[model samples]
Target: MLDRDIAAFYGVETKRLNEKVKRNARRFPNDFMFQLTEQEWSLISSQFVMTSRMKRPKKSLPYAFTELGALMLSSVLRSPVADETSIKITRAFVAMRQMLTFSTLPEKVVTLAQELYKLKEEVNEILADQNDINESTRAQLDAISTALAELQASRSQDATLKNRRPIGFIQPKEDEE
Candidate 1:
């Protein structure tokens, strides 16, 4: 990336970015960044429409940055925009690296899916066992209820017999006029 483009992406002015680079000169080595020749600058600048406000002298060539240079530039720039953008760019690169590193994602997913399936099957078996226990408990409770009902009927019959008079007793009491 060019310094101007990088600065624009980082929400800083081109001049400010260059100023920070100049201040931290050792931070950017030759491989990390280079200046475009006048002829190269001319070709590049011609590609973009330059208004009167955007006009610059031929001597003022833009600095070209490699990926490392751009990252270093972000670090050198201590402003909030640069800091936040640097963190984002760093995270993006890290994510890319992680994506590349985790090439076995499918295998991991398959393993996890198998484990989950086993867990689901185990849960179903436990539920089935609990249902069997519940059914047996319900049957026992029903049997106890029926037995209690029969005992209650027999007690009620005995009570009724005790309350009735003897079948052969017919006379009224002598004391009763």
Candidate 2:
């Protein structure tokens, strides 16, 4: 992102944003942020008509910040907007990482679902062939199969809930009740 764009987002002047970056020079390494070359800036500026703020610029080249640098700006900037956005951006990053980490889950779930289907089919066939199994017995088997499926689903979901606080109904005190 360009310094002017990021400044606009953080609700600050482009110069002010760059001032913080300058003061906290150690925080913004080469990978985090860098100044755009004159040629690059001209090309970019030509590609897109300059915004109102961008038009008024008559100083050093604009700084280009990577996503990490954008986050780091929140820490350097001491504004309510920056602080709030920083928290939201941090949470968004965490959520994105979680999604990426769980990208392989569909395959596992499909495998479990297929196994459950095969098990249910086998149980159904066996119950069908057994003449002694009545309606009640068949119903019980169906209920058991459903419960097994629920268990498998819960087991898979447990991994995600492992780090979260448990949620459940809390029994009231006898006197309170």
| Per-residue lDDT over 32-109 for candidate 2, one digit per residue giving the tens place of the 0 to 100 score | 999988788778877875444345565577899877988999989977999887776667667877998799799889
What is the C-alpha local distance difference test score of each model?
A: 0.82, 0.83
lDDT top scorer: 2
lDDT of 1 by residue, 1-177 (tens): 687778877987788888999999999999889999878877787787772225445567889987678789777986788778777766776777798779888889999999999999999999999999999999999999999999999999999987676467554454356
Q: How many pairs of residues collide in model 1?
A: 0
Ten consecutive residues with minimal summed lDDT in candidate 2? Answer: 50-59
Highest-scoring model, TM-score: 2
Predictions: Cα RMSD each = 14.1, 29.4
- Listed in order, each prediction's TM-score against the native is 0.46, 0.47
Q: Which parts of model 2 have CA positions greater than 4 angstroms off? A: 51-56, 87-177
Error of 2 at 43 (Å): 1.0
